[model samples]
Target chain A: MEQKTAIEAFAALAQETRLGVFRLLVQAGPDGLTAGDIAAHIGVPASTLSHHLGILERAGLLRSWRVQRQIYYATDYEGTRRLLAFLMEDCCRGLPELCGTALSDLVACCPKPTVDA
Target chain B: MEQKTAIEAFAALAQETRLGVFRLLVQAGPDGLTAGDIAAHIGVPASTLSHHLGILERAGLLRSWRVQRQIYYATDYEGTRRLLAFLMEDCCRGLPELCGTALSDLVACCPKPTVDA
Candidate 1:
């Protein structure tokens, strides 16, 4: 990710509401979740959720598709991966060993949790 | 890694000068680079570099200490790792295989480069 897009993606994830929404979507995995479902799960009003979704979409952290009347939201996996790589590119310098334990724990703890719509 | 700190860190990295300074620090590794050296490498004026450094420091992306008359700045490896983990917590969902190549490449390409002060 270039600096501009990295900044945008990070900014999108910077907010509390948006961060929760993105985390939920991440946990939802590739199957994704519907707009209504996300709003319900997050306990935010649909109107407010709509605004947060717009920010995430513009930042390229999310992708959406419509199935019938419902809009499904999924984490932009590639975009997120790029952002993560950018952040970790120089992590612990050349001492990967220093960061190894933490890295593995993160990967283990955050395994994709599929959510059915 | 909370919402507030993440926002501040991301905002600090959002700008061109600040980002450049950060990348320089990342490349410089744990041994770090002097403030003057960073300014010279990034081609930003001392006064301007000071401001940018201040932002990175305030955001916790950087740490600094004085060695004689020079102040050395280095990437906060722990802070950076947290940020990266946060971004990648759900990357490629359950398909770590999908992101493995890119992640490894990032690790290889950005190995820490030490600068002698």
Candidate 2:
């Protein structure tokens, strides 16, 4: 991703409400959550949640699709990966060894959720 | 890093000038670059660069240490790593395999510089 888009993405995430919303969506995975569900989950008013979702959508950090009468929100995983790559592009002077342990730990700790049953 | 600090860091990085300064520092590695040098490299006025640097420093994305009269700036690798990890903690629903290819490509493309000479 270019610097401008990266900045926008970062800006979208640089908020308490938005970050919570984004994280909730990430946890929800590709299945995503409806706008009403997100508002309830984050304990934010519908209007406030709408504003936050708009920011995330504008930043390209999220994607929404209508399933029946509900709009589902999900993380744009590719966009997020691009943003992370851009931020860490020169990480530890490009020496993955310098960042390997941390990256490994992150991966380990962030294991994908199994069946929600 | 906590959410608050992460938000601050993201806010610091959300700007054009500050992001330029931070990326310059990230590229500069542990040796860092002096404020004057950064101003020169990014072609911004000293005063403007100073403001940008101050924002970055306050957000903990950049660290400065004085060596002689020159203040060198470097990326806080740990801080950065923490931020990236936080953002990607639930990436692809914790499926590293989903992010592995992109992550590997990023690491490969960002190899550390061998020597300045």
DockQ of each candidate, alpha-carbon based:
0.22, 0.31
* Candidate 2 error regions (>4 Å): A91-117, B90-117
Task: Indicate the DockQ of the complex predicted as candidate 1.
Answer: 0.22
Error of 1 at A114 (Å): 29
Could you give candidate 1's per-residue lDDT for residues B1-117 as a string of tens digits?
A: 566776777778877788778877765657789999998898988999999999899888899999999999987766765665554454444454543443333322112221111
The candidate maximizing DockQ is: 2
Instruction: Give the winner by TM-score.
Output: 2
- Chain B, TM-score, each prediction? 0.76, 0.78
- Give me the runs in candidate 1 sitting further than 4 Å from their true place: A90-117, B88-117
Chain A TM-score of prediction number 2:
0.81
